[model samples]
Target chain A: MRFGSIIKVALRALLRNTMRSILTALGIIIGVGAVIAMVSIGNGAKAQVEAQVASLGQNVITVFSGSMSSGGMRGGWGSAPTLTIEDAEAIEREVTGIVGVSPEVRDRNQVLANGLNWNTSVNGESPDYPDIRSWKIASGAMFSDQDVRSVAKVCVIGKTVADQLFANGDPVGQTLRIRNIPFKILGVLDSKGFNLFGQDQDDAVLVPYTSHMKRLSRRTNISSILIQAASADVIDKVQKDITEVLTQRRKGREPDFTVRNQVELAQTATATTQTMTLLLAAIASVSLLVGGIGIMNIMLVSVTERTREIGIRLAIGAHGSDVLMQFLIEATILSSLGGVIGILLGIGSSQLVSHLNGWPVLVSTASVVIAFVFSAAVGMFFGFYPARKAAQLDPIDALRYE
Target chain B: MPPVVKIEEIHKIYESGEVPVHAVRGVTLEIERGDFVALMGASGSGKSTLMNLLGCLDRPTRGRYLLDGIDVSQLDRNALADIRNQKLGFVFQGFNLLARTTALENVELPMLYGARKFTTKQIRERAMHCLDIVGLSQRFDHFPSQLSGGQQQRVAIARALVNEPQVLLADEPTGNLDTRTSAEVMGVFQKLNDEGITIVMVTHELDIAHFCKRNLILRDGVLVRDESVSNRSFAATELEKLSSAEAAAKLTGAKS
Candidate 1:
């Protein structure tokens, strides 16, 4: 029997009952659609998280100052200010692959400038703060090491701070008062989008750690330390060396800090979303199975309904394999058709979601192909039994079937 | 010029529940090329069973049956199907034209399943020619449902002849038609027979059997009678006389 002719016959049979064919394929359509939508949305969320992690800088490592369990007291991360300038300086000198280090001290303060007042975070850092954070200076310059050593009253302003304090003027060479203490503006930092924690990173002030420790919100210990490795290849070695140096600095005392790398952070951030995508895909796959079952059900009913037709074909000299091929091809075409429509539905719904909810969505070609091939496979898998049953039917019995 | 069909002591036994029922017992027959034969019997006489055996739809349990001298009685299912495709044509009582399919496509079905591949144009041309032979060329595109009963049976005949089989086996070809339509269908069969196409028909009606050149009677799984038909009915004359009778009745009814 000719393959093309068999397919043509199957198509003709399906067209005979167009409404039933469409209804039978609906299960596969919805199933593939759900899977595509969920995968796109989940991948979009993951990509956003990875981008945020990357924004923290390439080959970057940070030592967070809490996770301390000492003397019947448990302190969570960022709660205890155990890290200090001395520890940051020690790691900078001891670690060989490090290119830059910044002692970080964070506090919230209200500042007044040009008769306007706004409340924002105050960050204290070294001259290498911009490089370690991948933050660029929009104008003017960063505070120099001389400024740090001399405890000069100078600070750089984030874009939000610059916009707020000097709406009509350049922020450089302006004086902003923190706790009524006047500080000269050195430069304006470029805009950085919100971070993984949903904090507006651009809404803050930058100052020398020395000046912050001595003059404003004076505190003893620094909040954390940020370090930049020379390259991605040396990140793990640099991270290991920093952990050893910090652990040695404690001198057998309970370790009060956690060492983390941006790569690790990115993995941790995207893990949940990847798993969610798989979970949604798995749930969607269940619907595909249901869709396959639907195909099998309809095919079985069709086989019974067309028993006399099968009889006629067999009587007219069609081989059993020909009858089998006819029905199987019909099933595969129905499912593949559904798969295509589902992919379109998925892309459209994902796009609609992204447009309406502002959630990032990534629809890859690989997933579309997989969904299509999978639905086709499902159709064949479910189509085989009924097709075989039709093929094995006795022509005499089938001819007499009412 | 071997005989188209020759069966020697063909026997068919069916294992129905417990007691083995012998459907055809020691039946021997020969049908030559271009011959028209009618196998006739009452219900339960196994004539249908013998017809099935000749069509190769079922294999006989014991015998040497040669279809166009091919010795097909012991062949497997697939081989038998191939033989049926290449050498035999079948028409059923129900005018088994595939419903919803146009007459042309219906006729093209057998060619699609044949052992030799045919180009689409070739298949279409052959099917159209067969339909033309059946005098249904104008109705080639009409579906079976759209055609009248006689027309549908004619389409079935076209389908049967599309493959140009050695023998055409029709099981009650005009069973579903009225008397005039039966005569009309029989006339088509006669016309085809005159063109040297062999035909075998199964019928219980004596008048229907008289249309064939030979009559075969099976009684209780046995061939009790086989005789060359005398004064065999010619469908064309019978149809003409019926039409004249109808015209006369119409005149009388109008006068009344």
Candidate 2:
């Protein structure tokens, strides 16, 4: 018997029950849709995390001064300034993997410019601060080393600060006052959107460390130390070296600073994202399994309903294998059709979700193909026993079926 | 030439449930080419079981059956299916036409499984030819549900003949039809038999059996008699008489 004729017969049988066929395929459609949607959403979230991690300089590390206990009250890690400019210089000169270092002193202050005043944090650092944080100057020039040594009253402002003070106009070479002390704006830093903590990175003002200690806060000790590793591979080594040098400088006393590497932070974030993606995928795949079971149940019912039809074909000279192939093909067509429909629904709905919720969603082509092929395989796997049951029926008995 | 169908000492025992039932016992018969034979029996006489065995739908428990000089009693299921496709065709009491299919496609079904390597065009042409033979040429596109009882039997007959098998087996082909429609269906069978196609028909009605050339009477799973019809009835004449009688009855009803 020609296989083509068998396929035609099977298709005719399926078309006879169009509503039943579509309903039978609905299970597979939902199964594939869930998998695609969940995986895409997960992938988009991972990408978002990756972009956030990239915004924090890839090779940078931060060392915050340890907290202090006084009068039964303990301050947070950055509340007390145990780190000093000498420690920053020592780590830069002694650490083998250290590429650059900058001592930082931060104080929140209200600034006056353009006949308007805004509250923002003012940061004091050395000339190498831009290199240490991988920050770029968007306009004018950065404060040179001579400015830090001569205690010149000059400042480099972030994009947010520049926007707050000057609005549409360029703030470079303009003068602003902090605590009634006039300062020259040397440059505007490039925008860095938002950090992982949801704080705007371009919301600070930068000034020379000497000027901050002498005129702004009157502090001799530094608030924190920013360090950059020579390469991504040497971050851990640089962190350990900084910790050891600080401990020894304190004469074997408890460490006075907490050193954290950007590489480790990024790795931790990646691990959490991967675990979340896996969890969502696992939950979604359960629906696919239920769908496969639905196919099996419907196929079994179809076999029972068409017993007489099978008998007639058998009496007319159809082989057992032909009957088996017919039902198998019917099941496969149902699933593959469902798979195609599901893929379209999944992609469109994911895009809709992204637009509505403003959440990132990535629908990869590989995932679509895999979901489709997997549904087809599910059809075949679940379709087998029922098809075999149909093929094994006795023609004489089947013909007698009411 | 060897008989078209020769069954020797055939016995069929069915293990249905707790008890084994013997459906056919020691039945021997020979049907020659172009012979029109009717099998007559009451219910439980095993006539249908014997027909199933002859059609190769079931195997005999003890028998040596030869169809066209080939021993088919011991053949496996697949081989039996092939033999049935190549050598025999069947018509059922229900008129067993696939419900949603057009008459032409129903007729083409047997040829799809036959041994002949016919192209699609050849299959279609041959199906049309068989439908034409059964006088359903104009109703080729009609589904079984759209057709009358007599027309559906004719379509079934066309499907049985499309494979050009040596013997056509029919079990109670007119069981579901009225007397007039039964005569109409019998006319189709008589015409096919006249064209040299061998036929085996099973019917409980002696009036229907009178149209065949010979008759075999079965009782309690045994052949009690096998005899040639002394006075055979012509199906075309019977159909004419039935239609005119129906017309007269209708005319009288209209006058009343």
- Candidate with maximal TM-score: 1
List the candidates' TM-scores in order. Answer: 0.93, 0.88
lDDT digits (tens) for residues A20-100 of candidate 2: 888888888988888888888888888888878867766888999999889989999877779888898889888997777
Structure candidate 1, residue pairs in collision: none
lDDT of 1: 0.91
Q: Per-residue CA lDDT of candidate 1, range A1-402, in tens? A: 798888888898889899999999999999999999999999999998888888888889989997666797877896787888889989988999998999888889999999999999998999998998888999999999999999999999999988887899998998999999999999999999799888899899999999999898688888788999999999999999998999999999888888889898888889988998999999998999999999999999999999999999999999999999999999999999999999999999999999999999999899999999999999999999999999999888888899
lDDT of 1 at A184: 95
How does model 1 score by TM-score? 0.93
Residue B160 of candidate 2: its Cα lDDT? 89
Per-model DockQ against the true two-chain complex? 0.77, 0.61
Identify the candidate with maximal DockQ. Answer: 1
**Candidate 2 lDDT for residue B7:** 97
